[model samples]
Target: MEFRNTLEFAQEMDTKDPLVNYRDEFVFPKVKGKEVIYFTGNSLGLQPKRAKAFVDDIMTDWAELGVEGHFYADKPWWDYHERLIPPLAKVVGAKPGEVTVMNTLSVNLHLLMVSFYTPKSNRFKIICEEKAFPSDQYMLQSQVRFHGFNPEEAIVEVKKRDGEHFWRTKDFLSKINEVGDELALVLIGGVNYYNGQVMDMETITKSAKSVGANVGWDLAHAVGNVELKLHDWNADFAAWCSYKYMNSGPGNASGVFIHEKHLDKKDVPRFEGWWGTKKEERFLMKPHFEPMPNADAWQISNPPVLSMAPYLASLELFEEVGMPALLKKQKSLTSYLEFILNEIDKEVDSSFEIITPKERGCQLSVFLHGQGRALFNYLMEHGVIVDWREPNVIRLAPAPFYCSFEDMYRFGQILREGILHNE
Candidate 1:
C-alpha cells in the first residue's frame, strides 16, 4: 500500500486492477467533448450502461400489457421489488426477509421512527449525532414536536470535542450513558454525509440495547460504500437511498432493513398501506390491516417500478462484484487519492487537510483552508466532477464500480494546476 504520487504508478495500478474493467459499464459525463474525472459517486453515481435497457424493458411491459403488467410482464410489477432483496440484503448485511425496497429515504425514516421512536414518561429523549444530514435534523425536531415534547429537552446531540471534525466511539458511547434511562431511541447516519466518518454502528447498537433503548441508522452515505452488518449488529431498523453509491437513477427507490426480531411483532405500531397487507389476503380487500410478517410490513404503497428499474439494473453489478471486492478497491483507491492530494498540498504549499478518518469508505473530504471555492470552481470548469460542501470542503469519491486509479491521477493533475493557477 505504499502509494506513489506519479501518473505512471497510478496507470500501472489501473492496469493490474482486477476490477478495472468495471469502469466500462458506466457512462461518464463529458465537458468540451472529453470525459470528466467523475468523483461525485458519493452524491450521485454515474448511470450504468444497462440502465437504459432496464427502463426500456419496463416501458415495453407497460406498453404491451397495460394494467395486466402487474402480473404478466417479464419482471411482473406485482413482485418487482422482491427482485432487489437478495442483492440489497447482501449490500447491507441483512437477510433477504429482513429487507425491503420501498419509499424515499426521509419517508422511510419517518415510518420507522413511528414504529421505533415512541417516547413515554421516563424514556423520552432521543440521542443523535450533531450535524446529521439536514433532513434527519428536521425529522427529529418535528417528531419531537409531534409527540408533545420540547425539542431542547427531548433531543440530545452527541457532538465531537472542540476542534475535531469527527466523533470518536467513546464520545458517542458516553453520550448514550449520559442519556441513561431517559433515552428512548438512538438514531444516526452510519456514515456521516459531510465528514465521511463511518460510525461504529455495532457498539452503538449494543450500547443502546443495553440501556433499554431502540436504535436505528440512516445509511444514506454508507449503503454501497462501506461494509455494514445491520443484522448482526442488531440495529433495530435502517434506511438508505439508492442513487448515491448504489448507482440508481436520481431520486430512485430507497431500501429498508428491519431486524428479524421485529418482524413477528404484530403489536408494533406503523402507518400501514395495502401493500403491507399479507399478499394472500391482499386480493380480498380486507377492511382490517393484516401486516406481512417481514420487513415488507413497513411498505406504505406499491413500489414505483420505472424508478426502481435502474436500481435493479445496478444491483446486478453489485451482485457480480460483491462488496468485499469493491471494498478492497475502495480502500486502495481512496488511500491513493489521499496520498496524491497530500503530495499536491506539500508541493504547492497549500493547506489541504483530509477530514475523513482512515476507517472511511471511498470518500475523502478535503478541507481546503486557504485555496477556497475558487479551486472547486476551477476543477469543475476543467471537467473534474467532485462535490463542494459549503464554506471550504471538497468531497472526492473514487467509486469502485466505475472509478479508476488513473481517474484519481487525472484529478490530482487537474487539482495541482488549479492550485497553481489560483496562486
Candidate 2:
C-alpha cells in the first residue's frame, strides 16, 4: 500500500490481482488517445465484449423463426425467458424458480407494491430511507396516492441521525423497532446510492419481518457488486436494474425475486397481466387470470429479447467467477482505495474528508470541504473517472468484473494533483 505514482505500480498490483484477467473481458472507454479510467460502475458498468454476440443470437432467431420464434429456434422464445432464471437465481442466492427477468426497476417496484404492500388499518405506513433514488421515491409517493393516502402522512423515512450522512445498523434496527407497530412494508436500498453504504439486508429483513412488516429491497447498486441470499434470508421480495453491477448495458431489463412461500398464497394480491398467466394456458385467450407461481407472476408482457441479451452475457460471467470469491476481491480492492485516500489526505491533514462508512462497498463517497465540483471536473480532465453528487459528495466504484487495482493507483495520482494544485 505504499504511495507510488506510476502505471508500473499499477501493473505490479494488477499482476498480483487474482481477478486481473477480468479486465480483458470488457470494452474500456477511450478519451483522446488514452484508455479512460472508468470508476463509475456505481452508475453504469462497462459493457462486456460477449454482449454483442449474445444480442446477435437473439436477432438471428427473430429473423429465422418470425412468429414461431416464441416456441422455436435454438433458445425457443416461449421458454427462452426461463433460461435466465438459473443464473439470476444464483446471483441472488435463490432457487431456480424464485427469480425472473422482466420490466424496468421502478415498474417492478410498483407491481410488487401491489402484491406486498397491502396496508391494513393498524399497519398502514411504509418505511424507507431518506433520499432514496428519485424514481423509487416517485413510485412510492404515487402508489401511496393510489391507495387513497397522503404520502406525507403514510410514508416514514429514516435519515442519518444528527448531521451525519450514514446510519449504523444498531440505529437502523432501533428505528425499525420504534415504528414496528405502524409499519406495513420496509423497502430499503440494498446499498445506499449516495453514500455507498451496504445495508445488511438479511438482518434488516429479519428485524422488519419479525414485526409483521413486508420486507423488500432495490438492489440497483448491490446486485452483482455484493453477495445476496434473498431466499435464505427470507426476503419477502426484491427487484434490481441489470445495468450497474450487472453490466447489462444502459436501461437493461430488470430481475425480481419472491420467496417460494408466496407462490400459491391466495392472500397475496397482484397486478394482473396476460404474460404472467400460466404458459400453457396463456395462449388460450381465456378471460380468467391464472398467475405463474413465484416471481414469474410479476411479468407484465412478453420478454424484450434484445434487452435480455446483454443481461445473459453479464450473468454468464458472474456464474463463472462466483459471487463469494468476487466479494473477497472487492473488499481487498476497496480497502486499498480507502487506505490510499486516507494516506493522501493525511499529508494535507485538514482539508478533504471521505464521508462514506469505513465498511462500505466498492464506492467511496468523498465530501469536499469547499472545493468539490472544481476538483471533480479537474479529475475528469486528467482521465481519472468518478462521479459527483449534488452540493459535495463524489462517488468512485471499482467494479469487480472489469475494474483493476491499477484504477485505484491512477485515481490516486489525479487526487494528489487536484488537491495540491488547488491549494
**Root-mean-square deviation (CA) per prediction:** 0.8, 1.8
List model 1 lDDT by residue over 203-273, tens digit each. 98999999999999999999999999999999999999999999998988989999999996679999999
Most accurate candidate by TM-score: 1
TM-score (all chains, Cα) for each model: 0.99, 0.95
Off by over 4 Å in 2: 1-9, 347-350
Model 1 regions lying over 4 Å from their true place = none
lDDT of each: 0.92, 0.84
Q: Over the stretch 128-160, how does candidate 2's per-residue lDDT look in tens digits? A: 898888998999899888888889988888888
